[model samples]
Target chain A: MEQARISARQLLMLAILFEHGSAMVIPLGIDAKQDVWLAILCGMVLGGGLFFIYYRLFTYYPSLPLTAYSQQIVGPFFGKIIALVYILYFLYIAARVLRDFGELLLTFAYPETPLFVLNAVMMLTVMYAAYKGIEVLARTGELFFFSLYFTAFSGIALVVAAGLIDIHRLQPVLEEGWKRVFRIVFTQTLYVPFGETVVFTMLLPYIQKHEKAKMVGWLAILLSGLNLAFIMAINIAVLGADTVARSTFPLLNTIREIRVANFLERLDVLFMIALVVGGFFKISLFFYAGVIGAADLFRMPQHQRLVYPLGISVLLLSIAIASNFSEHIKEGLNIVTLYMHIPLQVGIPLLLLLFAIIRHRSSFLFRKQEKK
Target chain B: MAREGIKEIFDAIERNPQFRTTASVVIARKQTAEQLLSVLTPIDKIPANQMIKTLEMTETVWGENLNVHAGEIIEDFSLAGKEIVMSSFRLDRNLKKGQQQENVQFVRPPARLRASELAMFKNGKLVRWISGEEARGVLWILNKIKQTAITVDWEGKEESVSYKVMRAKTEIAAKMKKGKPVLTIHVETEGDVGEVLVPIDFTNPANITNLETKLRKEIKKEIQKAIQQAQREKSDIFGLGEVVHRSYPEKWKKMKQTWNEQYFPNISVHVTVDTFIRRTGLRSNPYFP
Candidate 1:
């Protein structure tokens, strides 16, 4: 057994934590307006199908990671090229998540705090976790899972108790019909909080219950999808579609409106703590993925050796990611969704699956002839 | 103040976590806000928090609640929705009377309790005050009426009867009439006879029916007054525009730009009330009867 392997349950928690870290704060499937819940449902169904494809690919190459298997599936020349592309993709995603955390801190928690300093500190801690390997990361994620749910659920529970969530705001259900909701599900929303599950393709190979990894991956996507939909629905119900659309952080704004009584106010602090912890897990997982991919692609013996250098590079890349917050938001909402996400998260993965099936069949045929 | 001068204050407030926790926003007219801060005492046991509690209790029991929190104000005052109505309080002019009631003056300061007025805002600035019956009507239309009282004149008699409302429900339908915006307000409420001095058979369904008609008329009067006042101020504080947007999205897209000034004032408003007197209090018939 690999020294740093995780069980199916740990894998599920890590994926949920990673997807939830950013999705909970930023509004998901919002273009569908009050019917964003429907958008999320449609998107999740499609997201599950996409995850299954990735899982199928994983099953074909049970012992090998994406970096090693790409070369085997494709010719050595193009396969190494594809592997290098994935390595860069992981690194870039790590930096993007780092930027998200740093920008969030700069915007809400610390106005005086420099982005570089926040990124540097976060990257160092994330690098340490990544260097400790996936086993420690998985354990840490499993441990923090309870705390995350406690604070997040309690914050939302208070809001619901405060009578701030008006179901009337969600009235005239499917007023615009399912067509518009599905359109939004397809174009803008699916790949974001859902298709971002593609990162798990790398991590899935490390599950100790290798046969059940595929089942666990699909289950993780299913659970996280429902959770994302529920969270977004609560936000829309509390903040209203118009307000939720305008807000930069809908969950933060919703939590701020939670007034249970006189003294039990300002509970956004508790939610903020939960989100920061979640953000840590998200960034570290992506950072871990990047470190592992780099080590494998470069034919290195150990992933621990690549952590600090990758961490420093990620810090620098995150600082240089966007000029300001609005631009970052614009790119995140528009550019990333339309361009990078569709291809890297969805398109290339499907292509990988197709190629994997073809190669496996050809190799099996070659062995059959030799046996004869 | 220069923007930078305010920036320093913002920075300081943000830096100090305690400031954020204890902060209570008081929504009033600029002059009224000034007067409140002036009379607010240093020894007033956390005046900011006290004011918030006071505001909530008044809204809780009175049903004169209008959310004028800063965020709500910004939201309702936007182009999407163009009005803000908040419960308002003033330093009682007759503080001496309040002092007479209480042995210790400081224990209960002379802020008015029966505050049935709402500070009205357009585009985040106070435009006017909707007072008394009109304010209650605003709450009535918004379905916030709780433990409120409404009176009806009984059969041309000088004596009137008041019903103490136990529950109230309201709904506003925003539909177009002849290619223009129109609103219909429906109010359903049940209450007990609080005080009825007229000499009549209180148990008689015939008399009760007459009373119900008068009650509906009185409730309608309040709703009409609120509608008229909203028109006069050219603000859609009732949020009928939002109703329109939800039910009639395409129409709203065109009306939203002029909904506040042009369409709101001119829109036709129809009020309907269903009042059920569930209880006749301790006595079936009045002493006079």
Candidate 2:
């Protein structure tokens, strides 16, 4: 059913943008204090290992998506149940990311506009992208990749030119010790921007170069990881660790400090652009993954038909998820990362891989004995 | 209230067809808002509403006084964990031609730029004004000192031997001693000789070293004075509290309540200054020397 194929480069772009999406704005691993950058690096390393598991699982099937292959690994009934759970997980995460963008826009730009309107508008765009098929989304990622990098680099340049960064704030590094960094890495950072790539498993079968998938995934992780680390470091250096932790959107505040001349002040526009672009790609990818997964499980011909229903559901779910932004963030960091992300992203995938290996070994040994 | 006051000022200015143009304005808290408005008033129309010509130019101009924006104040306030924030602003008077000609042989401009003074805020309220070397000392500690001239005594008198700070870096460390925080501030500054009022010889390297020691002592004195004032005001303006919190988080939990009141006031501080004289200006020594 998945006929469209995306180039390896497109996959790389999509992955980078996905990882940088809402994670960039929200202070991921802020509990690490000034060593938040360090924590991100450590998380990226661990995330690399997690991706290896997903890659191995993908190799066993080769042509089938995670939804299709699970049935082959286990019985069809349980595999169908697993696929349904993953579909729900994908849609729920998509809603959560949508809410992230909506809340950011509400607080940063429009305090008066109802969050429903903001999220609905964002969801509409994501739905359109989802309906367009994965090829279109990948092409869009390739197009936006350069502009995103341009915005990031220019932001770094302007901040440096303004002499706002005082590296002294990042000093006394590892002051409290390694425990907090490691704790935050495992609990928050590793799962968030890194392990969220589990959604890509649904899309990996669409890649044209299956042989290069592992390399592309790892490179994308490294690039986005370093980008996030550097950006967070700059935020702490410019705004100070205390401010970064306290502020809702530290990057917006960091960009606001770019006053080269009197005329060149208030450059939060760069932040807004980067955020919207990143949010668009990220939300679209997750939304697409859910729609496609649902279509596959229900034995539907066109996944495009499910887009509108799922899109509306995601929009409403985003509003209903939490009473307020703080609650949303709290639930996300504490509950979702622990309960949802770990089990679906890591636990179930590893379980499937183990089952696939054991089943293959038993069948091979039985065939050999029969032949003898 | 501050926002309303600013809006009202701009509204009044906008309504006045007499003064149609105003570029930038930096209003310091040296005078009451009424007094400031009063000075701007008593407007005499020069020739049909170009009121720009009439009033005493109480408006602050660039190069005369540094303009501190609201964003910067908020950033610093948050960075220091709401303890204390400092900004520099000063009032400048545009001198009329007669006063400028009377001051010196050479024709001077029709304006005078006053030295920038540091304004300290505690809990978002303006607490005190710090001027002179003490203000510069705060700048040094904050690593905001870009170009400042420092005067050292030459030949047993406070004669002009000013070292212009080219660049500076301040490193603050908070160490736990006997379960209490002891602070150490290390300042490394490099500069050129700006002015030497007395005859000073740069021919011998010993003289340079001697000058360096004097400069170091002078910087140390300024930093101490600033710290003393901050402690007297019960404000940890140097972000020393943050340093302690960063280094020893568990200990800071108990110390947070009385940080400014008890710990900061009685906190033992050690200041170290390292001064390097890179160049002596146009000549090796002063032409007079």
Candidate 3:
């Protein structure tokens, strides 16, 4: 085993993606109308619980990766199978993330480019980071995190100064009852980047200090959640909720409207770059986790060999998965939201924790008997 | 599974041979000029030409009867201008000149002459004649016949007063209509005052009364009060200036559409103060000066 040290701030970058990705989808899914900010608030509250669950899992197995700890907690055979299923689940999610990035790029920038080209380029970048190991990924995240933060806040400030923002746009908040808000919250938390933080379990073992891991994890979640919520609020305030819902990329659309002195139009290009970089970190982390989990379950000599094949597979699968953007969005809302996310994000983790606790209690009893 | 579903849709679209990438054209034309004419030939159909009609034109040109193939395309046609040449039959010598001059000045009609001057012939010699203000009222009638020979025709009572006429150190007076002396006048003088009485014609008395009534109604205090109230409310919905402004845009552009901005300003308004002496207090004799 090699020493893999990731700082609290690097972990915070991963957490930002988790929160922002889901937060980004809220404006995409629900017809926010006049209450987009409210929709975002509801999403954060629901996403907070999901984040806490990941935090709980990180606390329980402080030093063990989820794949190894899962086997120890359950019987090896069943645990390995469970771990393999999780790996496959993660691979599917990683592929979908890659597809989202490719689709956004193709739609916004180069309409003539093939989907595979976009997918392949992104997959290669993620693969390079994944092959470098978690330390490099974490350090790279740490380096880029400040730039990402600056870009996000500066983008918001520029939009505001452009006179494009209307505070009145956020009015008539919570016009739809709590029920509608809850539905939006549930969809966002369940399927999107929020619940996807469960994949962070794979990275928990790499934290430099084990005790501060839980604190850092929770802090990352909180900060990222607030940042995402603010971004959502700004997007809605600037574009208005109705327009946000209609738009494919809410942030891009809002940024494109930023025209300071008539010369600073089309800021979406810069926005797209930020999105791709952030999305790269997000996708690469999941891809690495998927490969490592699969290798552990198969008792392979090295996980690096699985990376290229898995990368190509994801690229191909993403192209084959959705015919168009609308279908992709529909699958995200319907199948991914209802079936895949609930069990993986909420159910499986809780089950594994229960199993871990019972095993611990039984081992204590067995040791006491042996002493007698 | 999802990929297969999407593939099926694309396959179905490709397999449909009749599915066109663009819009199609339709045409309607006669198979032959007359069904009885069995000598007509049918041409092969092209995609561009779904239908075609044929006709015959007989004309005598250059001393020979020529039977020409002629027909309308009945839809759209693309022709090459280089393949055909056309010439006009009119001769250049028949064209008129000076009709298309680039510039020309317009002449105006003559102005009307003033009254009180008369042309006279004494012993068939030209001389000055007397015509005073008594005849001034009928000057327009007299001037119209001055250009042509005419005899005077009178059918009304007329009266006149004695007056002196002065023109270039000449004074002339004559006994006119009421057996009073009339003065010929070109220039004005204090002693040259003349008076004439002509029979009054009162045509359309009903219309005159109607007009008077309408004027009186418009001049009422209640109408003025309503207008004042509307002005205070800043409701120029009546569009008084809008009407004039619309009729004369160039003149009104300097004023600007400032009714909402400045409200109404500099508009001079006058209210007529009519005091009826005969109808004071509804009794003519009770009026006190």
Judge candidate 1 at residue B59 and give its lDDT.
66
Clashes of 1: 0
What lDDT would each prediction earn against the true structure? 0.74, 0.77, 0.52
lDDT top scorer: 2
**Distance (Å) between predicted and true CA of A307, model 2?**
0.4
Interface RMSD of each: 28.8, 26.8, 43.0
Candidate 1 residues B14-80, lDDT tens each?
4565655234334543334544544443233444555677767766566665544544443454546
Residue-by-residue lDDT tens digits, candidate 2, A257-348: 89997888888899999999999998999999999999999988999999999999999999898654555777798789889999988899
TM-score of each model, paired residue for residue: 0.56, 0.57, 0.55
Q: Evaluated with TM-score, which candidate comes out highest?
A: 2
Runs of candidate 2 with Cα error greater than 4 angstroms are A367-372, B1-289
Q: For all candidates, state DockQ relative to the true structure.
A: 0.01, 0.01, 0.00
lDDT of 3 by residue, B88-184 (tens): 0111111122122211121211211111122221111222221322112122111111111111111333222111111111121222233221222
Residue ranges of candidate 3 with Cα displaced over 4 Å: A1-3, A21-29, A368-372, B1-289
Cα deviation of B7, candidate 3, in Å: 45
Native contact share for candidate 3: 0.00
Residue A49 local lDDT, model 2:
91
